[model samples]
Target: MSTETVIPKVEKKHLENPTGGSKMEKVPGKPFMEIHDEINDEGQGNFPLILDDSVETQTQEDVKPKRMRKLTSGGQEMYEKEVEKYTAELIHYRKNLYILINSYYSGELETLEVRLMPDRINKELSKYQQISEKFIGFLKRYRTAESAREEATQKIIFKSIVSKAKTILNEIEIKLKQAQLAKSFATGRKFKPPSASSMLIKQRAKMDAAKTNLRFASKEAEPERLQFKLEEEELKTKAELLKKKVEAKLQMELLKSEKEVAIAETEFNAVREELEMEGSRSSGKSMASVVDPRQHIERYLQKQQEIMKSVYINPQQMQPPELNVHAAPFEPKSEDIRQTNYEINNVSVANELSKFLLKKESIDVSFYEI
Candidate 1:
């Protein structure tokens, strides 16, 4: 009966396990190990070891931290009630924070510092909105104006270019017509002859020389051309002078003829007056003795001796004036003189003599003869 003392090893097994349990068997003096296994309800092998305990040793792996398990039945009810209280308080705090943030955003939280801060912010926002709209409108107008200006400028440039092109085309057409005219002239076509003014100066000189030489052989060897031309001018002048002299002589002859005609007319008028006076003075004489004798005076004088016995009988003579010693010379009556002048015939005496001879032939000479 030697007296021997046995040392017992104690180790933590499961942290979630109770400190002491009546269901667990206790070893009095021997070291015991408690292990916890993660297993299915059947406690199969090869499962994960969650807790392990060893005699005389404690390991960090044995005491591992885990999520808290559900509380005890009595404590679970009280824990749920406490959790509800805490959640209510936390929700209230979160709601309060959100309200603060929202109020800040809405410009309502600054009311203590500036009384009308929210109103001022709202007013400033409205003003900014108006300014933005006005700016946008201005920008739109500016863009429209710029576009219009650009389009107008483009149109103007295009029109100018088109006008220039048209002018060029017109010029080209004119040039083409000129080219065609030149081509036609080059061809054998009998085109309109060139104008005298269009002839070249050298060509006109050659033509004038040839014509001058051909017309005048003297000009072919003329020593002094100007002197020869002067001589011709002198000849023309002389001929013109001669023509003028002849015309002057003819005009002088015409004047002489006209003077002679005037003189003859005057003499004729004088003779007519004398005839009328003589005829009127012999009005008391027999018509056969005076009128007929005066009408055929030239022919009657030529045959007076032969015709006087048959045609020229002595007219009855009026009684002579009384040779009274007491009577004065008688004045001629004015009416008698006037009537004598009015009765005279003013025709040609030669023509009257021929007419008187013709009249005798027409009359019956047998009836007058006794």
Candidate 2:
């Protein structure tokens, strides 16, 4: 190695350079919007802002329609649809009522059915009234709608509704009167069933005494006590029939329950087999899910069913909620008309229709009493 090692000397240069040019130096500035606020000219109203023509056109193109202060449009169509619906419902009700009343007038209807007509008419009328009231309320709320055609149509429709309601009311009044008159004549015309001893003991005793007197006075071969003995035997037969009816109804209910159980078992078995085939066991994820509570519950029930299938269950702890349905017995159409809920004293019928009288019964004596 040489005594003097070749050492590279670093060169130093003094270089003066200006700061780098700014990136934004070449960018154009935004146009300034000048606002004039001169105080001297006070007589003239405040001048609107004068925007550039291009800027004004662009803003106008981008502008959206502003909301109206009131309902100027869009509600008329919906209102008309509601009116049509109301009209259709009212027409149907009127048609049904007309058919019933006319049938009664023509002697083509039963007295019992005629009695029911007024109630049916009144029910329909009440339903129509509710619809009308609802419509009136809706109309009241929308009276402020600024559409001229809408306002005119609403007035016309309202007048029509008022007229219709008045006509219907009158028609119902007439029919109700007809019903009341028919109902009045029907009083005491029904077949009076023998009263049970428990229901009316005093009435029953009075009736028995009256019947005994009639039987004695009339040409009956048997004695009064013998007639009562026969009646007791007839009552026993009626009781037996009633018991059989009760037993039959119970048997039917038992059959229904058994059928439901069989169906449930079949459905459960099918579901279990299907699940087994799919290898789709009810996982913990399927047992509970926040997204669908009903689906989770069904899965849980299915899991329980699977468990019941695999393991022996003594009895289910919970049962389905029972609905207590009380079916009303169909009473025979009795001519013995009961008083209705509403008063009918104010109601009146036509002179010709109101003259409904009880038929004159004729019983000529075949044998000479003298």
| Model 2: per-residue Cα lDDT over 1-370, one tens digit each | 2121111221122211111221111112211111224312221111111112122112211221233235435766776676667656655554454444445445566656756666766676566566656655555555443322233433443444345444445665676688888877787577476767656988788899999999877656457768899999999999999999999987776676666556555654454344333222322122122353234345555765887788974466656768657867667543323222111210121111122111101111211111
| Model 2 TM-score (2 dp) | 0.24
State which candidate has the highest TM-score.
2
Residue 7 displacement in candidate 1 (angstroms): 99
Please list the residue runs of candidate 2 whose C-alpha ends up more than 4 Å from where it truly belongs after superposition: 1-70, 144-370
What does candidate 1's lDDT look like per residue over 129-171, in tens digits? 3433443343333333332332333233233323433343354
- In candidate 1, the residue pairs with backbone N, CA or C atoms under 3 Å apart (3 or more residues apart, or in different chains) clash, namely none
Q: Which residue pairs come into collision in candidate 2?
A: none
Give the TM-score comparing model 1 with the true structure, all chains together: 0.22
